[model samples]
Structures are given as C-alpha cells and as structure tokens.
Target chain A: MHKKNKPIIVLLFLLPALVLFIGILIWPIIASVHHSLYQYPTFSDPGEFVGFKNYIDLFNKQYDFGKAVINALILAALSVFIQLPLALGLALMLGKGIKGERFYLSVYFTPVLISAVVIGMLWEKIYNPIYGIVVKGAAALNMSDVIPPEGLLGNPKTALLAVFIPTIWQYVGYHMLLMYAGIKGVSPELREAAMLDGATDGQVNRYVIIPIIKPIIKISIIFAITGSLKSYDLIKVFAKDAYDCSYKVPSLLLVRYAFHNAGGIASAIAVIMIIMCFGFAILVNWMFKERDLYGKK
Target chain B: MAKSNEISFDSEMYSVKKTNKFVSALIYVGLVVWLLIDLFPLYYLFTFSLKSTEEITGTNVIGLPKEWLWSNYLRVFKIGKKVGASQVRLFFANGGLERSFANSILVAGLTILICLVAALMATYAITRIVWKGAQTLNSIFMLGITIPMHVALYPIYVSFSKMGILKSYWSLIIPYAAFSLSMAIMVCTGFMNDIPKELDESACIDGCGTWGTFTNIICPLMKPALATMGIYIFLQCWNEFMFASVFSDEAHYTLPVFVSNLKGSNITDWGLVGAGLVLATFPMLLVYVFMSRKIQESFMVGAVKG
Candidate 1:
C-alpha cells in the first residue's frame, strides 16, 4: 500500500471536497473571528474595522452580552445535568430484560422524530393555561380553582423552563439509546460475577454497570452540552416571542444578528461559539487523552 | 440471607431475589410513567388532528374527539391550494406538494452520493497518505462534527447568494455535503483503518491507480459504512431546517420547511397541521421502525468527534 511515489495523485483526488469543507465550513469561522473585530456596515454590506467595540458592547460593561452568555451557559448546564442522567436511568431500565423493550423504545422515541414546529404546537396546547390540557388535567385531578390558567410559554418567568421541558423531552431518547449502547458494550461475565458474589441488583449497578458504562455517560453528557449550546430550531419554534425581544440564547442571538444590515457582531458570536466549542472539545479530548476513551466524568 | 437458603427458596439462593423483583417492577413503573407522559404528547396530536376545531380548542387535548374525521388528512393535501403565495410560490408552486417527494429524493440522494464519494476519497488519504497535513485535514473534518450549523449559516448565505444559486436545490445539497463531510470522513476512515493495507498493494500490483483503486477496491469494501452514513446524512437533510429556510426560498421548500408554513397561512388549520406533522415525521418513523440498528451504529461511530 506504500506506493511510495504514487505520483501524489491521491492528494489531488482529495483536494476539491477538502477545499469546500475547508473553504466554506472552516474558513468562514476564521473569517468570522476577523469580522467580529470590526463594525458591521449594514445588513447587506461587509463591515468595517471597529477594534474591540463589538466585544465591548457584548459584555454588561457596555452591552448586555453577559446576560446572554449567562443564560446560554445556564441552559447548557441544565440540559447536561438534568437531561443526561434522566436519560441514563431510563436507558438502564430498558437495557435490562424489559419485556416490551422494542415497543417502549419506539414509543419513547416518538417525540424526537417530529418536526420542531409540531413539537412546539403540541406543547403549546399542553401548556395552554386557558384551554391547555394540563390545566384541565390538573383541574380533573382536583387541584384546580386556585391554579392559574396559562401555558408555561406565556409566562416570562417560566417561559425558558417551560421551553426546556420540550427540549428535554424531544431528545431524551437519543441519549437513552447512547447509554443503552454503553450498557450493552459491557462484558456480561463481570455482571454475572457480581451476581454470583451475592451482590444485589443495586450493588451490581452501582459498582459494576455504572463504572463500565461511564464512558458512554460522559459522551452522552458532552452530547447534551453541545446540543443545548447549539439548539436554535426548537427554541425558535417554542420561544418565538416567548422571551423579550432582547432575550436570546447565544445561538439564536447570533442567528438574528447574522441577518441584520451587517454581521460583525454575528461574526464575533460565531467566533465565541467556535472558541467555546473548541475549548470544551479540547478539554474533553485532553481528559480522554490520546486514548479517545473518556474513563468517567 | 440464611433463611432464604434454609427455605431453599425457588431454585437458586438469595431469597432477597423478591426485592430484585420488586425493584425491577418499580423500574418498570417509573419507565411506564415517563413513557406515558412522553407519548401522551403525541397522542394529543393524534386526538387533536381527529377532532373538529371546537374539540382541540376545548380544554382537553387528549379527550376523545366529538367525531373522528379522516378527512383532516385530505384537507391538508387540499390546503396545498391555499398554502398562500409566499407559501405557495415558495413551496407549493411547481406543485411542491407533489414535487416534494421527488425533489427531496434527489436532494437527499445527491447529498448522500457526494458525502460517500468525497469522504471515501479523503479517508483514503488520511489512512494511506503519510504526507504532511493529512492528519490536520482529518482533524479539521472531525472538528466540523461539532460546529453548529448556525455558525456557518450567514457566511454560507452570503456566499451562495453571491454565487446566484440561492433558492436552488444545489444551495442546500452542496452545503449538506459540506456539513456532513466531517462525520462521513471520520466514520469511513475508522472503518478504513481496520482494512488491512495488503489489499491495496495487491490491487496496485495489477496496475490500479488512486481513483481506480478507490472505485474498484475501496468503494466496494466501504459499502457498509457508506450505507450507515448514507442514512444518517439523508435524515440530516430530510430534517434540516435553518439552512433550507435561509438558503432556499418558498418555491424550494423541503418537507420540514413546508411543514413550517402551516403557521404562515392566515387561516390556520390545526388538524391539517397535525396531519402534515405526521407526514413530515414519516421518514424518521420508517427509519426507527426498520433501521434503528443502523441508525444507532451511525451515532456510535460518530461519537468519535474529530
């Protein structure tokens, strides 16, 4: 295979597609880092140089960018902490000898398959304070008269949390599937040994199963973090006008800014995102070391 | 513990086994409760689609429809007529409702092809080429896996518009290829590593060149990974939103974009919208039903980000 002098033609074969990937995908990111240093001229025009001004505007020092950063981090942390473990527990349940695993897996996964628009609609109905089924369901449960009728989406206080519910619901199955694969990858003999040693199910899970599947758990958490950081579509549907005009996540904030007269600010946001994502990814990589397997989180 | 052995419980020892049963039952109960809550949302959609406006607009979405209407599905298709000019011209015009099935087929099909060919070619270089910068190319593509689609949106919008391909399927199809190349490369390259090098030497001894060896040798061997990546790439395109929204106009609406148009109509039809939701989600349903294993493997392979 070491055709030592294979004319280097192979490199040429890779050049075109590589160019597109590097040129469009990678270069824009690099360019965004540069542009963010300038001031956007207008929505359509390429921006002009304005050193550190936009970045200054981002922080509460001058702008409220800190709030957006705080909110985005909160949302990401919440998704990872809350969503990942719940999915792990559920995956553990099904990974055992659940009788109707296939049916239940499919049923649980139904939410992730639908359009984000439709998901927003479905939850919109459920959260409807007036006619939302949750209100009526609560009323039927006899906890009613004092309860206010309003979808969580309607309340500014609860809006972000309310939206987070659907976000968690929609993708839990994906994480569950990932964790399930992790559990499945474990060697069965060790589990049987734990059982033979008079270990109870809980002890087996605590000592053996969880430890074996820890890599997947870490991967699932990483997936959850990046996913929540990058989330825009689901929020676009559910949180449309749900938050104040100024309220936005880093992802959506940049997206809206990208469409304006000029996108210097948007470019800056993209740079921040790439840096955060890269820094986090590198952190994970370093944690995993060259082994590419993270032992446990 | 001794009492269970003394009683010689059922078969094996550890009469504490009943506790295990109880725990499993409890696990089932918890899973079942969440499953119901999780699935109940979909049932609400189903029931709402079956109901008249009065029923959905009623307080209980999951309540049985006053009357089940199968016609709601038909109405969605018919709503194509009034899908609106912005809606109609952008999507439904040129018979998008009719053309969508075919257009999506082409876009998805072509994207899958580009990803496969490009990734396979590049992966070979990563695996076999010891040339400098090959490793860098491999990691860059790997890093592309986590690069949010939104980050690339505006720059691509400006570029594609500048190229005058804005609103054409090429805009999406090309970008989709670019977006997915990293994952595809990582996957195929992993599989390529496990492929022994002797196969290539043997082929080259018979006068195969780079492209020739790829098409004749590697292409055939790469089919399994290619198939798995193909499905992932296809689903990504099928469900892609932001770019298809920003890059393409109404007439070029993909299925997800078309489904979003449900809201834009002055006269909103929740029933038809639900029906369309089902339609929009149909591909994934089919995938989960039949291709879940492959889909799972795709993600597992993709877990190795560049």
Candidate 2:
C-alpha cells in the first residue's frame, strides 16, 4: 500500500538516531584516530603532528601501555580459563531441570544487577587490613603471619588477583544465564535418546549437550574476553588515583591521560582498546568456526 | 542364564540410582555454596550500613550491628550540613546526598525517554519502511555495538567542552541516549519483526497514514519491548560512572559517582559510606525484585556488551 515517495517520512524517523549515532559514537572514533596521530597536549591545543609517536611511546615507561595491555590480557585469560569454566559448570548443572531453577537463576544474577562501584566498595571493606573480614578471618584461623601487614589489595603480588576476584565473580551469572538458555534450547528428545542409548548424564552432557551449546560457549568466550579487556569500574574502584599500581588497565590510563593534558596518549589507548576488542571478537569467532568445520568434516 | 543376566541388570540400575542421588546432592551443595558467596556481600553491606563506626572498626565486622543504628542513613542524607549552614541551604549544596539522587534520576529518566523515542522511530524506519538503504543503515547502527565507548571519551569531552555543554546534564544525556540507541533499536527491531506487517497494511486500509499507524498501532504494540529497553537504559545510566564523573561537576554527580566519592571525600565514616552504597543500590534492587524476568530477557537481547 505504501509507495516509494514516502522518503520524507522515513528520513524524518531515522534522522534523530542516525545523527546521534554519528555525532556521539561514529564521529568521535574518527576524531580519536585523528587526535592520536598528533601531539595533542590538550583538547583545544592540537599540537604538532607526531605521526604515531604516541603509539610507539605507549610501550615506553612513561606511558607503560604495554604493561596495561598485558594486565588486560591476563584478565582476558582468566575470564576465558577460570571464569568461563565455572560459569559453564553452573550452567550445565542448572540446565538439568533442577529444583527451584528460577530461584537459583535470579539469586545468581543479583550481583550482575548491582553496580560495579558497590561491588568494589564491598570488596574494599572486605579486604580492609585492619577491620576487613579477610584479616579477621585470617587472625581467627591463626594464619596472621601469612596475611601481609598491608592486606591483600595492598600487596603487589595479590592486588591484581584481589581486584580480579570480584570482577570475575560479578559476571559468572551473566555468562551462566546465557549458557543456561542455550542448554534449555537443546531438545529434550536429544537428551532422552542419549540416555536411552545407555549414556550417563555426564556422558550426555559431554558428548551431546556440550556440542549443541558450542555456539553459546563461543559467544560467551568472546564476551568474557572483550568484557575483561574493557573492565574499568571494579578495577578503578580498587586502584583509585594510583596510576603507578601494578594492576593498571587500559581504561585507567585512558582517563588519566585525558585529564592530565595528554590527549594524544589517551586517544592512543582508546584506539588500541577498540582494536583489541574487535580483534579478539573476530579471533574467537574464527577459532570456533574452524573447529566446527573440522568437526563436521 | 537369562535370569542371571536380568539380576545383573537390576543391580546395575540400583547402583546407578544411588549414585545419581549422591551426585544431585553434591550439585545442591555446590549451588548453595555459590549462592551464599553471591548473597553474603549484599547481606554484609546491609548489616554494615546499620553498624556503628565502633562496631565496624573494632569489634564486630561481619555480624549484625549490636544496636541497629538507622541514624547512619540519616547522617548520609545530611552530608553537606555544616555547623553554621542552615538546613535549606545545605539541602541545595552539591555535597548533599539528595542532589546526586536528583541528578541521577533526571539523567537516567531523560536518557530513557530519548532512547525510546529515537530508537522506536529508527527501528520502524529500518524494519517497516521500504527504503533502499534500510539494511545498510541497520548494519551501520549494529556496528556501534562492537565499538567500545572508551574510544569516544576524549573526543566527546573535547566536543562537549567546545560546544559549552561540558558541565550540563545534556553532556551525559546525549551520549548515554546515543550509545543506548544501538541496543534499543536492536530490541525494537526484534519486537517489530514479531508484529505482523498486516497491521500496517490494515491500518492503511482504515485510512491511517504512516505517523498515525506508528502512533496508534506500532507504538502501543511495542509497549513490552519499550519497557524492557527502558529498564536496560535505566540500569546503564544509573550505574554509569566514568563519563558521569568526567562530564559533570560536584552538583551534577550521579549516584554511582557520588557513592564512589563518598568514602574518599570524608574522614572514612564506614557506616555513612555503607549507607550511601545502600541508597545508591536501592533503586536497582527494587527494579530487580519486580522485573527480574524482564531484566534477564533484556540482558539476553543485548548480552554481548551489556
């Protein structure tokens, strides 16, 4: 019933979102790329064109972008190896038509609903050296000497791990829910057939259910990796204004540079983050697709 | 021989059943343990919020407050009050808790409104309209999902400062709504697909134009989707910190930034900080309680970077 010349109406409807998207999101990315190539001491100052000097300088001690990149990579590794496995285990268990399934699902998801700042603050209190539960528990167990005088978050060896603990904990339910939904989508007939073939529950999950939910698992891995790389709030909460901390991620540096008249460095960090996120996402997708092809062959 | 085989099968079945029970029991134990880990911090936060500074610092760290002091919450509310400042004067001060609460609500509310209206129209244009470049336009918006907002921070700051909207609420609202549009359009498109195209055709037959059809037909039908998207947008805007912190001044601080700064600016009043955390989380907790299923579904729709 609609003809072609109703273009005005379509344009009217699309204009607001398109303008906002281009202005706020797309154009700034272009601006960031442009800004990263120069000696942008401040937003207004657009200094001499440094030509990727900022990018190269990132690896130096001044910026230490390489270390932050490595820290973020370590977090991505932990998410894929440890966090995803735990989430998968919970997803598999919960997928088995468990009792109080809804209750468990909702309860597990509570942490995800709460703000990261709150989670970070809670952990800060929990790791407080003098009054924290961790120290108190250690003292109660006669392991007072084991815990350093400077608490878990204070110790260089443990601070990154300490910061990551809550970060990983907060999102286990998110990945679990994604996997749970995927598991639920597996036809019951498939499970029943496997059981009738004398397969135990573990065997069925290993050989049948796991294969069926591989796509979800792939997506989970991508999300886990990208999410870890983009992680800011929880880590920032733990490492407040301490730019020299061992647990610095790309984001902390980005914000610090943006404010400290180092716009070029900040833009360089932002570009690298975007690249790494897109890279990992594509890499995971490709890895999963290749494996699927091999399996099919 | 047949009878002997039958006996062996029966015994095997019995053992399998017994182990299944044990395994299920173990699963329950694991789930319960994780559940406690999940809930303990929140429980501790609530109890900690009510504890005296003495109890929190010295005697009881994890237990319920010896005396439930609701005054900690009141103290958090009365944060900006000085010895000489009048009540009404301090109430309007940026340091007061209520100002952040108002800021957060106004930012979140405007973000939700802008996202819904803009995304709804855009989704209709892409999904329902028979335009030549609709598919191209849709993919362009989808690309926004992959690009993290960090890349835009410096540029946004620059632009906002240049445009002189750096400290205004629009600084937050515009960017938030813009970023949220991708997810909103994604959700709206999903819902728009399920709505049979016949509605638009039938509406045309009934003498309704494009605007009339959207307003009278599609908008009403998209209510559930809109609500789900609104909630997601609300969660994002309310909990956002980095941009809110950078963009806004003291008087314009959102709840997350406010809660985060609460401990830093003061002389470490643990109870008051706890109270502020509770107050920051209360709205989200209420949303979770009432609309958990919708929230989960919303997460599923935008789960990848949500």
Candidate 3:
C-alpha cells in the first residue's frame, strides 16, 4: 500500500460505480432535459428545436399531462395524510411489545416483499365485477344497492380511490416497519421514566416515543410523497392503458408518450416528474426543519 | 391524615389498573383484526389459484373448493394445451413464462453481482479510505438516491436504441445496477464504517495492501450487510417493471413483464391469471420467509440514515 498509489487505488475502486452512475443515472437526466427542449419524435432524427413548446403541449387537452400531475399529487396527499397515519398507528401498537410481535411484524411486512403486479392481480380479482368479494359480500349483506356492481375499478368516479387503496395498502407495512425500528431504538429508560411519572401509554408514545422518532417519521414522509409521485407498477396493472384508464399518473403518461413516438412530450413529463419529486423532498426537509424538536443549530 | 391519603391513592390506582387491562384487551383485538386483513388476501390468492375455473366463477367464491385443482400450477408451466372445447390454454405460448423466469434470474443475479462489487469498492473508498474529494463523491452518489427513475427512462431508452441494445438484457441490467447503486453504497458504507479502523491498521502493519485488507478483513465482516443488500437488490431487479417493460422486447421480457402480458392476453382466464400471479410471487415470498429479519434490518438501516 504505497502512499503514491493510494489515489490510484481509490480511483480504481471507484471507476465502475462512477461509470455506471454517470452513464445510467446522471446522463439520462441531462439527456431528458435536453430532449424535452426539442421536438424529437425518434432516436435517429432530432427533429426541430421546440424549446418550451413540448412542456406547453403537455398541459393541453390532447396530452392531458396536467391531469396526470393532478392524479399523482392526489396520491401523494393521500399517502401523507392517510397511509402514514395508519402506519404510525400500527407501529405504535406493535412497538408496545405485544404478544407474537415477531409473527405480526412478518405478516404485516409480507406485502412489501411481494411484487406489485401480483398484489395488483390479486386485488383485481377481489374487485371483479361479477364474482368479486365486494359484490358477493354486498349481495349477502343485502347492500347490493350501495356497492357498485360494475366493479369499483371500472367506474370513473371511484376508480382513483379503488386504485389507490392497494397502492396505499401495499406500503403501509413498509412505513410501519421503518417506524417500528425507530420505536424499538427508543431507550427503555425514557419510557420507564415517563411511566413512573404516571404517563399513560398514549402520553408516553406522544411525548417520548414520537418525538424521538421524528427524524424517521420525516424520512417516511419524504419517501411516501416522492414514492407516490413516482408510482407506476401497481397503478399500471390497474390502469392497463394510461389514456384510457380513469386514474392516470405521470409515469403512465410518460411511458405512453415514449411509446407513441412523442419523445419530446415524454421527456417533458419526465423533467416535470423529476422536479416535482425533488421539490417535494426539499419541501419536506424544510417543513421538518421548522418543527425540529431538538432545536439544534 | 397520611393513612387516609394512601388509602385514596391505592383505590384510584386500582381503578386505573382495571381500565388499563381493558385498554390492553382492546389493543389486542384491534391488532388481530388488522392481522386478518393483512393475511386474508394472500390466503384468498392461494386458494383461488387452486380452485377450478367453474368453482372460481361460481357463486361459491368464498367457500373452499370441493376439489382443489392442483394441476392449475402444472397448467401454468404447460404450453399450448386446450383445457376445454371453447378454451385453448397456452401458458408460455412463445417462450413466455419459462423464458421470462430465466431472464429474471439472470438479470437479478447479474445486477446484484455487479452492484455489490461496485458498491463495495466505492463504499470502501468513501468510508474507509481517507481522501481529498471522498466527501464530494459521496454527496454526488447520495444525490442519485432522490432522482426519480422516470427521468432516466426516456433518455436511456433512446440511447440504448441508438446503440442497438434496446431489446437485450444489458439494457435492463445496466440501469438496474445503476439505479440501485445509491442505496447499495449507503448500506454497505454504513456497515463498513462500523468495522473498527484498528483492524485496517493492523492489517496494514501485517503487510496487507488496501486491496488485500479489503478482501481478507473487510469483505468477510461485511457479509451481513452484503446479504441484506443482496436480498434488497435481487427483489428490486426481479420486480422491476418500468425499465424491463420499456427496454426488453417480448423475447427478453422479464417475469414481471411476462406476468403482466399474461394478464392482458388472458383477460378472461382467471385460473391461468392466478397461476401466473403465483409464479411471479412465489420466489420473493420464499426469500422473505427465510430472510425476513435481515431484510427488515437492512431496510431500516438504509431508511433511517436517509
């Protein structure tokens, strides 16, 4: 290990990652931005330079990129407000050292491990118009008049909510597992002290455990919002065709345009999605900073 | 006066304990209900996969099948066979399921291997090796963590098409490895940082070069983190649909893509669709069942740090 060769060794060790990172992640993002400015229809032909026209076209009725953005935002909101609270509740409950904790933890986390396609397929069956459990249960309960017989996923009015349930459900366990780990790491001494001072379980969780795991919660919020914005696979399974489906997310629209040979429009959508993801991430960090409980400078 | 105060306090404490027991019971009941909600879908999927088409479509959807058609699993693997007069069953009509399964294995395996080697080296350098610009390099890699994959999709597709590698496994492998590198580096680096610097110093004193120290001392110590990253990487590569769908043609379709295509083509055949879902889900399920703790720990470690 000569001192002279140390820098070379570092370079040698880092070359593969640097190459792949630049080639796959960095270059594509740069190329996406560049392509977004041009009216390139195909790879061979660069076509005319369109500047911001592609971005403008995205908002027009023909492209409906605005709708896609709205849909993703709606999903992001639901993830933050609904999905995360559910996960926090579960984490707190499980964090209390319940019986069969290990078993419960594994059961809850199983969905995160399974492929979204599989979960989507399974849910699709459960939402089937004819023989689905929803229909059957509604009938058996004599509440068929209320529940949609044509399947919730097929109905334009309920499709977004229907599609989002599984999306939200699939990740509840993921966030739960994260919060659970943080909860577990909270010192037993703090909890004991709180209890000794006559703090109830709820109070201890609220004042002690929750505050201690604020950073983890903040991270979860970022993941939830960003992941919701970039969501595709499970939504894809339900949507099938992006334009045709009632629930259209940005990724679906991006893929649709890419395949339709509208490369510029697709790239524009890509750039917008990237900006939104990054913007949301920064927003979350700023929000967390404003509410920093530790008061660190 | 002191005795009376103690008596009142004891009575109040006893009442609080009674309510606590009731609250505990309520919590247990709530947990049980959630557990059922979580497990029911999987159970239904399994049972539905084993049911006959008639049974599945019948009014008795909730009931257990009278005769479990275990052959549905067999039928999924079988290609080009007519089940009934009106229905023609073909699982992998043109190198469908089996080919896609092999492709998934190859892609996932390669991604994990490449990602590990590259991430391992980069992590060792960034964390263990003291360098001038190491922190800057680390920050750059960290930036990759938040960049949405969609931003990379269109460009990668165009470039690969231009290079005439759009339909090959390289298209999928390279991006999978690349996109996954950030988290992989983060996890490995966290683990590598935990290995006492004293060990590296001792190894250096014992005539071990940087490469030798990394290989003999650091690599073995990184096994747990490596395993965790391996599982996470494998899951990501296997279940990755966005890049695989866009990049790979039918001949090179991975399992997720194949399964998706199967669902679309066989929209009417619930049994076959169930079988396809089962096929796609089983491998990951097995991995989870065996390595649940490691996966949880790794995910937490990566997530908490972020």
lDDT winner between candidates 2 and 3: 2
Which runs of model 1 end up more than 4 angstroms from their true locations?
Answer: A1-7, A60-63, A144-150, A242-247, A285-297, B1-19, B80-96, B266-268, B304-306
lDDT of 1 at A273: 79
Which numbered prediction scores highest in lDDT against the true structure?
Answer: 2
Per-residue lDDT of model 3, residues A130-239, tens digit only? 88888887888998887676789988888889888987668999999999988987877676667667778899999999999999999999999999899999888888
lDDT: which is higher, 1 or 3? 3
Residue B305 CA displacement from its true place in model 1, Å: 9.0
Task: Tell me what TM-score chain A of model 3 achieves.
Answer: 0.95
Candidate 2 CAPRI assessment class: medium
Query: Which pairs clash (backbone N, Cα, C closer than 3 Å) in model 2?
Result: none
Q: Write the per-residue lDDT of candidate 3 for residues B1-306, one digit (tens) a residue.
A: 122223223325432322288888888897888889888888788778878778888745867777888787776765323344232323333445776888899999999999999999999989998889999999899989999887898888878888989889899999999999999998887888889999999999999989999899999999988888888888788888898888888778888887777676677677777877887887778877897888777667789866
Native-contact fraction for each model? Answer: 0.42, 0.65, 0.73
Compare candidates 2 and 3 on DockQ and give the better one: 3
- Candidate 2, after superposition: displacement of residue A218 in Å? 2.3
**Which model scores highest in DockQ?**
3
Candidate 1 lDDT for residue A8:
61
DockQ of every predicted complex = 0.43, 0.54, 0.56
**In model 2, which regions exceed 4 Å deviation?**
A1-4, A290-297, B1-19, B81-91, B304-306
Q: Model 3 clash pairs?
A: none
Give the per-residue lDDT of model 1 (tens digit) for B173-234: 98899888988888888788878899988888999976788788888988888988987898
